[model samples]
Target: MPSTDFLWWRDGVIYQIYPRSFADSNGDGLGDLPGITARLDYLADLGIDAIWLSPIFPSPDVDFGYDVADYLAIDPRFGSLEDFDRFVAEAHRRGIRVILDLVLNHTSDQHPWFQESRKSRDNPYADWYLWRDPRPGGGPPNNWASVFGGKGWEYEPQRGQYYFHMFYKEQPDLNWRHPTVREALLDVFRFWLERGVDGFRLDVFNVYFKHPDFPDNPPRLGLRAFDRQQHIYDIDQPEMFPLLREIRQILDAYPERYAVGETFLSTPQKAARYCAPGLLHATFDFTFLHSPWRPERFLRAIQDWEQALGDDSWPTYVLNNHDNPRAATRYGRGEDDARLKVAATLLLTLRGTPFMYYGEEIGMRDIRVSRSEIKDPIGKRYWPFYKGRDGCRSPMQWDDSPHAGFTLGHPWLPVHPNYRHRNVEAQRRDAHSLLNYYRSLLRLRKENSALRRGLFQPLTFEPRRLLAYLRQDEHQTILVALNFSSRPVRLAMGRTLSAFRWRPLISTRDEPLMPRDGFLTLRGDEAVILEREA
Candidate 1:
């Protein structure tokens, strides 16, 4: 069980704010710090305990804000350092913690360290980034492909060597092998901590170190061509754990502060190691996000995580993020968007800290970006084979107005065309809207201790389309059931649970649960929370 004594984050629900798409204060068609400040009350009323703002640091927009050019300064487009201070202060006054995104795995080429490192091989900042001498023919040092595509190494004419970059060519991988480099990154963390920020969500935390010997990656047999090569030479290095310990030590100095790492490559067993005692506080589990919508699939994934992480390390759940397509697009029926709320209910009710992506509460579907409209580098390069994240990262639909009320000026990316009937304002008036459902669910989750820290055990002996689980503690045991099929299911009146009297708490329908003879019939897609009675 997680320690209940300290840290507000243990029970906190974090709402992820994709800064560029959240709001526009100055009519620049971009979200600024002040824009976020304006929405604080809306978030507070939604019952979120903390906010995880995506990157707003200075960058060249190579990959939006992932490529950091300056760690300490806020981008002029997002507002200034003073604006951040006000936002943090206002959020804290209203009882919400703020966690900033810290991207230390790589830095934009425009960064001062990268600028000087590219100049020569023996400069003071030369070792700050990964640089190696080229082969005899002067091609890239190795046969490693970047995540964006093509060779991972970029040639520098001035240094006559190849430099490593896991992302776009403009974002060079930092040399964590260098002592000065590690210290410099820690200094960046301290800069934010000293500025009164609550914590950090470390970006690409698992890719901090690579093989010191620079070994060649072996190709795989049946995996995707991209996954064909072993990542042993490039990532999931053992040394990265020690770096997390160091970061945790620094973060421990502050009060009510916590850190979560985006360590994607680690296995369920290995991922837990990053969040176990004396290391990072938490690392999100992607097992659910990666799994398809299947009863057995979800059951197995949750069980695997519990067994892997054991009882000490906490797990986090995220159904959608900026990188993936929205859950409404991926998990919901194409014609009926209300089904997406079923997913939200599942995520928010499960034990762990839940993260809701921007626009997900309102059930916003993915926007369609045509080939001519695509701006993402990955989308542009890989066209017909795979459309990039441009569709998912389009501007948020705020209301049923022009440009979805996101901006008066031209938006960086076009809003979804279906924003007419599926926006926040339209949903606010409807009693059964997705936004109100989320608000109700969130408020219920906050009020129920069992839902927050309950032990999950799935029951599989019943109907194949029925998903039922128990969240129990000594004082209370709550059963949550959902019907995934189109037909009504009469919950089997089995001998195991027939003796107990059950009281209904919340159901998708308005009627009270009839516990006559200890059996209940549920409609298609219906969900319920029941409490045991004496």
Candidate 2:
């Protein structure tokens, strides 16, 4: 079982803010720390407990901010170190915790450490990165493939050797086996912790360590070249466990601090291993992110994650992020706001920490960016078949103004075309807007103890389209029902729920749903939460 003492992160909701797209305060066409500081009031109004900011460290923008050039300083495009300190202070003043994105697995090739390491074999920092001699045939050292496509090894003539990079060629994997490297990375964590960061979101955490032998991955049948191999030597090695324990020790030194890991191409069972007493507090469950809108698919994912995490572990859920397309564009094909309401209700009522991406509350869809305006390398490589992530990483739609009121200058990416009507200002005025629905759902989750920390019990129903579950505690039991189809559903309460008086608390539709003859009716794309004493 988990510790009897409660941690705020275990029960709180996290709002993910892609700093570059959130708001531009200086009219520079890019969002900055000051821009986010100005929006603290808006986030507080949304009832979020914490804000997880994506990487803001200095970078060459190869893979956006994932390729970090410096661990202790802020990117010039975003702000200075003083601006970050001010942002953290302002967020805490509003009762909102700030979580920074920590990329320890790799660094930009332009980093001083990598630059020195590539100079010569006798350099002090030569062992700081993974360096190896070429194969006997003068090709790459191994058969490992980069995630961005092509061989993972890059021939660097400077040292007459090849360097390893898992993502882009601009990012070289760090040598975690080196003690000096480990100490340097730990100091980075300490630097941010002393600066008042409440937590960290570990990026590609599972791939920090690789097999020492540098062996070739076994071939497997798959669509992508990277997926064509089993990836046994590239990631998820047993060596990661001890490193995580050391990281946990650093975080435990701080009061009420937390760390959540992002597992790349990992299963729930694999993710659970990193969340014991001395490792990560939680790991993101991607089952829901990849699942369709079908009820059975979602039910299976929830049950699988809960079972895998077991009683002693905690789970986190995310429907959309900087990498994936918006949920509204995925699930809400014909029905717009109605589908969004159901998604929000399901996210908050589920048994885990809910993470909401910015602009998701206002039914923001993925903007179609042309090839000429594309900024992401992945999208440029995939072209018409896969248009890349620029669509989802567009600027937030604040209002029906020029550039969606995100900037006075031309925004980095185009705002959604529907921003004229779908924006925070327009939705805040309407009571039935998707933004209001999200606010009410968050408020409901915060007010009800049963919804926040209660045990999850999947309720069985005959209707194949309805997804029902019960969240129960000693004081109350809340039943949540969601209709996934376009047709109405009439669900029978049966003897199990006949004894309790089910009163409607909240629903997607404007009118309240009343039970008649021990049966409840749910309209098309409707969801409801009913309360009864336990």
Candidate 3:
């Protein structure tokens, strides 16, 4: 079991804010630190314990803020360092923890270290980034492919060599093998810790150290060039273990600080290994994010995560993020909110920390981006087939005003067209709105210890259309049942649970049907959480 003592992150909900789209203060068309500071009360009132802000460091915005040009400074486009300081202060005043995204695996090509390293091979910072001479056949040194597209190695004419970049060409991979490089990155962590940051969300963390020999990845059958290879040599090297330990040590020095990593091309088992006494506090498991809305698939994903992580390790659940399409758009039927409600019920009532992407509570849908208005390089390169991530990265719809009250000026990306009727302001007054449902669920989770720290036991014997699980503790036991189908389901309580008297705590339907005999009948796309004294 996890520690009995209170750990804020383990029991809390983390609301991820894509800073560029959250709110635009000063009519700048882009969200900034000041804008975030102005909205701290809204987050606190929403009942989220922490806010995970995406990258706001100095960058050229090639891949948004992921391409960091300066690790120690804030980007002018977002705000100055003073603005970040104020944001932290205001968030803490409202009893909210703040975690920043640390893109340690790579740096922007425009970074000073990379600029000097590329000038000459013998410079002091020359070894800071991965550089290799062309092969005898005058081609890339290895067969590794960039995640964006094409070869991972970009030729640098000035240095007469190729630099490695697992992502976009503007972002170059760092050489973690070098002691100087490791120390420099650690210092970056220290800089933030000293500035009152609570934790870090490590980006592409598992790929920090590639194979030393830079061998070619074995080929496989797939659509993208990157997917055609097994990625054995390009990512998830053993060297990353020690680096995680070092990062954990730094975080431990600061009280109540935490770190969570993003694992690339990893399974539940791989993600579990990253969390322990000396590593990350948690790692995101994308099993549910990639799976279709099926009962068996979700059950298997949850079971796989529970079995792999054991009883001690904490797990994280996410249905939407900056990289993926909106969950409502992916799961919703035309004009029906039942599916989204069911999804939200599963996310909040599950036995782990739940991460909510901005606009998810309002049932936000992805806005289609025209080819001419596309900003993502991946969308531009793979147009007509892949429209890119701009759909989910649109500005948040706070109200029914022009641009959804996100900004006085034009938004960086278009607001969802449905925002006029489906926004936060309109939903605030509706008792049955998705936003209100989410708020109620969060409040319930916060008040119930069994829901927050209970042991999860899946009712595997249930029918394929029903997903049932029991979260129990010494104090209370809660039964969660979700119907994935569009037809009513009469679910058996199973032999193990039929003896107890179940009382309804919350349900997706406006009026939930109580348990009759040993079975509970649920409407299409409905869910319920029932409590029984332990």
For model 2, the stretches where C-alpha displacement exceeds 4 angstroms are 1-6, 461-463
Q: Candidate 3 local accuracy as lDDT? A: 0.90
Model 2 pairs in collision: none
Per-residue lDDT of candidate 1, residues 46-108 (tens digit): 778899999999999898899999999999999999999999999999999999998999999
Reference-based lDDT, each prediction:
0.83, 0.90, 0.90
- Candidate 3 differs from the real structure by a C-alpha RMSD in angstroms, to one decimal, of 1.7
Please provide, for model 2 over 33-100, each residue's C-alpha lDDT reduced to its tens digit, 9 standing for 90 to 100. 99999989999999999999999999999999999999999999999999999999999999899999
Locate the minimum summed-lDDT window of 10 residues in model 1.
Answer: 1-10
In order, how many clashes per candidate?
1, 0, 0
lDDT of 2: 0.90
Q: Which regions in candidate 1 have their CA more than 4 angstroms from the true location?
A: 1-7, 222-225, 461-463, 516-518
Shift of residue 329 alpha carbon in model 2, Å: 0.5
Put down candidate 3 lDDT per residue, 292-354, tens digits, no spaces: 988889888888998899877998999999999988889998546889989999999888989
